[model samples]
Target chain A: MIKIKSIRNKILVWVFLLFLAIWGGISYATFYQSSHEVEELFDSELAQAAGVLSQFASVVDLSHPMIDPKLQKDIYGHRYEKKIAFQILGNNTLNLHSANAPTTIMSNTAGFSDQIINNNLWRVFRLNVKEQNQVIITAERYDVRNELIHEITKNSLYPLTLMIPILLFIIWVGIDRGLSPIRKLAKQIRQRSPEKLEPISVNFEIPNEITPLFSALNSLFGKLKAAFERERRFTSDASHELQTPLASIKTQAQVAIRSDNKDTQRHALEKVVEGIDRATHMVQQLLSLARLEPLTSLDETSDLNLYSLTQTVISELDAESHKKNIELSLDGEESIQIKGNQPAIEILISNLLSNAIRYSPEQGHVDVAIKKVSDRVQLSVSDSGPGIPEQDIKRVFERFYRGQNCQHILGSGLGLSITQRIAELHNATINLSHNPDNGLVVTVEFVAKN
Target chain B: MRILLVEDDPILGDGIKSGLLQDHYNVDWLTDGGQASQALQTDSYDLLLLDLNLPVKSGIDILKQIRKTGNALPVLILTARDATEDRIKGLDMGADDYLTKPFDLDELLARIRALLRRSKGRTTPTLTHGELELNPVEHTLSMSNKPVDLSPVEFQLLQLLLENRGRVFPKKQMEDNIYGWNKEVDSNAIEVHIHHLRKKLGNDLIRTIRGVGYVIDKQ
Candidate 1:
């Protein structure tokens, strides 16, 4: 699996890029609007200046004679005023001009136009003075107008340039503060020991964004604690149950050694063997219970015939039931095939059958049947034994819980638990009920495969 | 001394019974809690050795019932549960002592002897009456400081009578103490053992009251 990038870094990078894009767009719009407004303002000023010059020219006397144009200068004129020059054109001749004016008509047009005078580009606005029968042209260089536009844009953008670093710093701090709860939670989890399964408490108030995360983690801790508690109880109970048989074996061995009579010694020795067998059975059952405890998936798959499987388990237990004079029989649909884990299904069948045979009275009957009911394959095992009490039926599936009625019987009490676990693995259901006459009927139903 | 041993496991119960018998104490072994409870209600025993996990009824329930009836029987709980909480519960429920399973037989015998001694209102394991002295632990009988040999049954009979001096024991009770449930006894088995004990310990040591039973005088 690829390592995921940190949420904090991702948020920071994306937000910063989005802010930079928005700021750039706004700055471009502001520059575009102000530059257009400045160009229009400068054009109006040139028109007004041309109109005033035409009025001044119409007022001046030109009937005497045409003379060479003299240098016109204003003592109070600004430095850029030198770049603005005008001329009066009468009948395609230069009549009057400023100091920077060329000795030629700038434009023949009667409105604003561009002209190259003395190899320099100029913006000339011409006006018609009808009383004088002449046109007055006001011209300014292209470089001067460009220079003024640049100044306006620079002054307008100065604040935004300075605000960029400050905005980024504020965002970085805000993200850090917002993510502090998650960091604290991580630190608390990292410092915890495996044995300590307590729920973590964030010392600071959790932000809304990560509250669900914290709650989920706490719930997981709760489940883990419960699982650990269950494991501990199982280990303790298993040891205690094993200790009894071990004690019996030890005490019986002592009895054998202390006995002087041959018959007594032999009896003690036989008891020792019985004790060993009981302990071995308990250990085997404990191992089976442990194996089924973990929720591991069953890997083995095959088509299992319930009727045949029941028959095989019954045959294996034939001698045991025979010793007690109990009759075992199987009656059901032949070749009832179901898809399942073969060994797990076999174990499930074996436990139910053996339990029935073990709990039945002498000469009692144990009947097993399998059938297809609706969308399910149903298997039922009923035995003519003293049924469990009403209160103990629910507790029978718990590990090491023996019914009060069946205390005389030898059992590790793990059979039903294992059976239930296998049923769960197969997505099946098992139900137990007291027989109407005097026994228990266990029904296991598996979903039928098409 | 007679002990009522209520244990569910057959092998362990049988082994304990055999060991107690070897020590010259009468033991009536029972494997069912209900049956043991019935015995406790109907009969008299010196000490009760009860196992916690039993059939039909649990050992703790039986002990509680016994105590509720004002039966101050010294009970020693024998079980495989060694948890501290279990031990405390057993003791708090009026058990005189608690012994975990897989226990040493020697330790069990020692605890039994102590309980028996405490019940009889005595501290020593040795019983003495006039010139006769008996060491219950060593299973020895001596008269006037000289060792005497006695059969196992005769020794057990003499020990019972000596332990409960001045208390009359009928023939049936005496026979029950001397023989186990499986043992077959002749009609005159108790009389024959009494005869052998009188001959060895002297006739005056045991006084047989007419139509009652035998008792050893405290004097």
Candidate 2:
């Protein structure tokens, strides 16, 4: 749960803890083994001292035993040697003894024993001598033996204890050297501005473990640059398209204001209204198309009968077709169903039918057919209108692309593009073709909902 | 003066045509670039008002075609594109003037007058020959400090001859200046207009060259 923000600090803490744990383990192991070896050697020396005294007692005369009370001290002196003691007994009475031996009998027991003599605990070894009543005992102080064990343990741990800080310093430096590339990368990113979207290319060497990080960052920059370019072009195109209408409105208003003749002035004023209408329609269309840009899918959808939907759209534009004197008819299956958002689909249908009526000659016929083609619903609108040129058909879906035949036609030129987007959202396909009358036949195929 | 106005938008083109007619500049309006290009190749005009974004062809391409053929008509680009690069491209390709869209109509008319005056080798907005003065912007004519009342055709014909000063124009050339694509002009329309113009001003102002054409002699 501890949050270490710095990468350097995280690595340093974990590595330092590992060093401490390993140092403690090795120091404890050295201390344990040395103490065990010292204890075994000292115990065997106690038994051997008892054995040597018994041999000397058997070889020499018992009644004239050499009582070397200061004999060992006279030969050599050591702090630990002063704690060693021995005695020989005949009939439970003291006979021969070392310089450090007790004046009284140390032990009457037949084997090794720990005893308190004169308030000092000693490790005593007893053995039988040459005669029936002869015995020898060897003893060393218990506290002195423990002191020797601790001394050996302390010496073994001294070197390992000195190594811990040196290892800590080395680990800290190694982590810093390994993560230097990260600091360089952060500095490079901090220096960047939005206008500069070029991919990052570092000069220094990068390790293989972090190579994917740099490559991922560069790839993201590439994607961001492409998206920004697309948005910029869309804005430029929208402004250019909008400017044409605004220019028309301004020019017509100017003409109306400047004309002296009543008829010309009235006609100019009417055209000013028309220009305003056209500009308003253009902006609305641009907005609706822009609103669809970020939509991955429709938020709400319902299963609707295509026949009824097309009929409803046709009625909505009844006045438009009536003014143009175009005969609009609907046919095919009556209750075929498809799933789509109602408003979006309504715009698509309205655009298509209006376009048909607008382009058809006076009293020309426009037919709409909806039916189930295999598992899909097919909706087609055919008109005896001027069709797009064969070469221009490819560009018909482009925004603001008015074809050669449609040059004089009053249009915002974004209808087909909007329809295309709506079709994309519904997972449908729209096809443009020519009928036998050399007019346009637009067909949209949608997945039929059972 | 006659001017060819090429614009793709229906409302704007109509408005410009009406405004140009009000100013007494015989105007032929076209809604497509290809038609404008064909018209430019086959006809003559005093000035061209061109829109860059068109259906069949672009204004830049039409300008290039006209310049390649050595047609020296004054071209003014009227476009919705306001980018510096677009303006530079239009001017560097032999366009005499460039105006961005949403512009004032008065400014457009002024620029047209300046370009026409420059093309006629005149430093001022008014054309003068001796005691007669013609103001293109006002579409007015004055002689000897008195205003002269002349018909629009008579005024155009007199202004054309006066702007050229020493040049002689045949009868066929005068019909193009006085009428546009749809107007039906009579055979002796230019002569009758000149007769009216001479009667209003003076006899020596416009003189006939006999077998050649009509010429308004320089001072």
| Model 2: colliding residue pairs | A69-A99
Where is model 1 more than 4 Å wrong at Cα? A1-4, A49-111, A115-121, A126-139, A161-230, A288-311, A327-349, A363-384, A420-450, B32-48, B55-75, B91-97, B110-137, B140-219
Per-residue accuracy of model 2 over B1-219 as CA lDDT, tens digit each: 889999988888888888788788989999888999999988899999999888789999999999999999999999787788988999999999999988888888889889988998889888777778888788788888788877888888888898877789988878887797678888888888888887898798887999778887777
Question: lDDT, candidate 1, residue B132?
Answer: 84
Q: Model 2, residue B47: what's the lDDT?
A: 95
Q: List each model's interface RMSD.
A: 1.5, 1.1
Off by over 4 Å in 2: A5-7, A44-169, A180-194, A202-219, B66-73, B216-219
Query: Clash pairs of candidate 1?
Result: none
Docking class of 1: medium
lDDT: worst 10-residue window of model 1 chain A: A63-72
Q: Each candidate's fnat, in order?
A: 0.68, 0.78
| Deviation from native of the Cα of residue B96 in model 1, angstroms | 5.3
Best by TM-score: 2
The lDDT for every candidate, in the order shown, is 0.84, 0.86
Which candidate number would show the highest lDDT if scored against the true structure? 2
Task: Give per-residue CA lDDT, model 2, range A1-450, as digits (tens).
Answer: 999999888988888788788878877887788778876787789889888877777778767556555556676567777788888887877777877778888887878888999899888888876556788888999888889877887877777777777777887788888898998988887876667788888899988978999899889889988888877777777788788778777887888888777888889889888878888888989888998878999999998878888999999989988987889999989889899999899999999998999899899989999989889999999999988888999999988777888766778889999999999999999999999999999999999998
